[model samples]
Target chain A: MTHPKRVQLLVGSPRGKRSTSTAVGSYVLNLLKQKGLEPLASLWIGHILKSPEKIDEFLKAVEAADMIILAAPLYDDCQPYIVIKAMELLAAHQREQSTTQKRHDGKLFSVIVNCAFPEEHHPETVLRIYRRFAKDMGFLWGGSLAIRAGEALQGRQGKTLDDIGSMAKKVKEALVRMADSLSKGSPSADETLSVIPESFSHGPLSFLGSFFIWLNNRGWAKQAKKRGEDVNARPYME
Target chain B: MKALILNGSLEHQTHLAAIQEILEDELSKAGWECESLILHRLKVGTCIGCFKCWDTTPGICFQDDQGREINKKAIHSNLLVFLTPLTWGGYSSELKKAIERMLGLLHPDFIKIKDSYRHRKRYDHYPSVLGIAVGREKKDSEEEEIFKTLIKRHSLNWHTPKQKAEVFLDKDDDEKIRESIKKIVVEMGVRK
Candidate 1:
């Protein structure tokens, strides 16, 4: 007669349902439901009040969940202000949990940052920010996904229907993989780091690679200008 | 020069007080007129992202609460200092709420300049920001973590001089930290 444990979802996009986070959040929730797991989706957009009552409500949901997924759009290269508030609330809630001798069992955590820039260009700065939060809040981060602008949204006719379908399928697959890891309660500490390649990566080699790309981009700009072509002739490569 | 000091730390904690005391003295030494807002003592709410400011209103949010009131002062100041405690590798909940609420000033719908224009059609002034995050002795490293977490690429790209300062109060060198705060204050004091 026991029901499956719950997974609470915090989607931080002021854009609401139209946000890429919503798309990914829905995919994750549906994936969990298919596995007979209850997914509670909480949309945290505008007006993140800090009243005790509001904090208590959010804490109750977070504590009840087996895992927490923080989905947000990258703003100013970081999460929206509400996401920061949510993390603050969670940290404080943990202190309360400690007094009651109840350790939070919420295991897996991940971030999905919908950035306007192509995922390849500069997702690192945002990823670094998210990973640091994940560590500070004591969450076992699975990974992250960065959905570039104009790739999947409405009225972006460049990507074919098949491309969109593939993207959705890949996203669904990633969510399922993450869920399976979460259910085991033995999540790895590898910190998959969600580098889309298409996104940025960690370590020294990536830094060197980035520097080279910067050099190349600068060279391209110089050559264009010398040719009397507009350096702004084309938007900077994603 | 006028400086607006905002202590966004919840409960007006000692660490923020240390920063304020040191900053005020340094700023006074440098001859800057300082106006500080100890944020936690005031009432401020999170941004609702209503977009009313951009679409319906030109430069004001519908909510004329403390956040907007503070924004008015911020506009008048030449420098803005945000002193906050690092809570879970980021700013305090109260601080984040205050920053987000300031979004009303950046509403594109409120003032639109066409791409062809080289200058702003209507200018909204934003003061230089100095973000200082202090962590407890047991969590000094966490302060840097939060600093990295909060400073985004786009923020760095902004032409304004927005700098970040951090101190692990538990293991901090008071003199060096004071000097750093002083440098910022002195610059603010001398700026136009």
Candidate 2:
């Protein structure tokens, strides 16, 4: 039997030491290793992205990888600058160079955003920012894992959220399926990725309304209230 | 309204041009003079998160990064507009790091508080935000929902001017997106 192709996972975490992002990256790396496919994982910190050269180095790594999984923590409800910046540079480079040469056609792109609170709902709106980034760069999105912030490192050291167990089996199963797809060159199994759907829609009003409901249902409404907004009277889409 | 437009696209990728044209046209029609800072052409760095501006340094972050200059412009402007592209569901890292390093606006003086959380006088009041997230979405066309949520969340952070509007351009249709921009511009009072 042929050995599966090598996979490169780029981990984007603003948190330097002892982070939930690293924990998830470790888990994915281990699972891939257990499957006997060579997986290379590296961490990219946001603060270190000082110049275009640094961003270019990251794009090079992403180009070499068969699949890229972004393991990041939700900062201020979105991916930190390092991850976003890295993706932007990569996409730009691909677009600029596509006419001259074939850009990296890395089959899959995935994100595991570890947030402080994990709901049984969809990923945050901020994650949609990355979805747009991935789509522009022409990566076949492999889906995302919005694990409860704390659960990733429950057995280890550092902060862990309460709902890790709530989505463990489901998350693991999803990751396994994603890994298989990466090995086989197929679309990810999680077809209901919330971000991409909103990106390509013509119905802006309907999309805006649904997103407003989704945001309110999550802790965003409370945050808005904390900042002194009557969420009920003023609907988001309005 | 004197508006400044910052395009963050790299060389040859014309997406930034599209956004600039739409935004500039709307703002100019409203009689606003607009300027742009295309960040990809600028020299900048991420915020180190060192609290030097709060204690060690007065009215300055130790690092002489581009954030200080941008912050100055933001402070001077009536309506600070950021024409940033979405990266991983957030602002570009350059913009993000630049945003974090804006703590130079905070005063050097600080006071200890009672309960637990120490409070420093917030130096810079955030400007009214009108974020436009362009690109693809999941679930066929679900990215609009995500952009809408992003806009709402971002708006919550600001002391908004009673009313605001947002445009989510996930799909790459210039004409349709142009129409959306027109609508949002009217809501923002930039177009009569």
**Chain B TM-score of every predicted model:** 0.78, 0.73
Against the unseen true structure, what C-alpha lDDT does each candidate score? 0.58, 0.55
Off by over 4 Å in 2: A1-3, A15-18, A41-60, A96-106, A117-122, A129-138, A150-238, B1-43, B48-64, B72-78, B85-94, B100-125, B132-148, B159-186, B189-192
The most accurate candidate by DockQ is: 2
Residue ranges of candidate 1 with Cα displaced over 4 Å: A1-5, A14-20, A41-54, A116-126, A150-238, B107-125, B145-149, B152-154, B162-164, B170-176, B184-192
True contacts kept of each: 0.20, 0.27
DockQ of all predictions against the true structure, Cα-based: 0.15, 0.17
lDDT of 1 by residue, A61-139 (tens): 7767777777777655566777776776677667666564445433567666666443344455566666666675566
Task: Judge candidate 1 at residue A61 and give its lDDT.
Answer: 76
How far does residue A226 in candidate 1 sit from its true spot (Å)? 43
TM-score for the B chain of model 1 = 0.78
Q: Which ten residues in a row have the lowest lDDT in candidate 1 chain B?
A: B110-119
Candidate 2, TM-score vs. the true structure? 0.59
Going through the candidates in order, what is the number of backbone clashes in each?
5, 23
- Tens digits of per-residue lDDT for model 2 on A1-238? 2333566766666554456666566677677777777786474556336566767676676677767777876554566666666666676677777475645444577777765432323245655666666676667676766664233344234333223655355555556776666556555543322222232222545454345334434442354356454323211112
- Give the DockQ (C-alpha) for candidate 1: 0.15
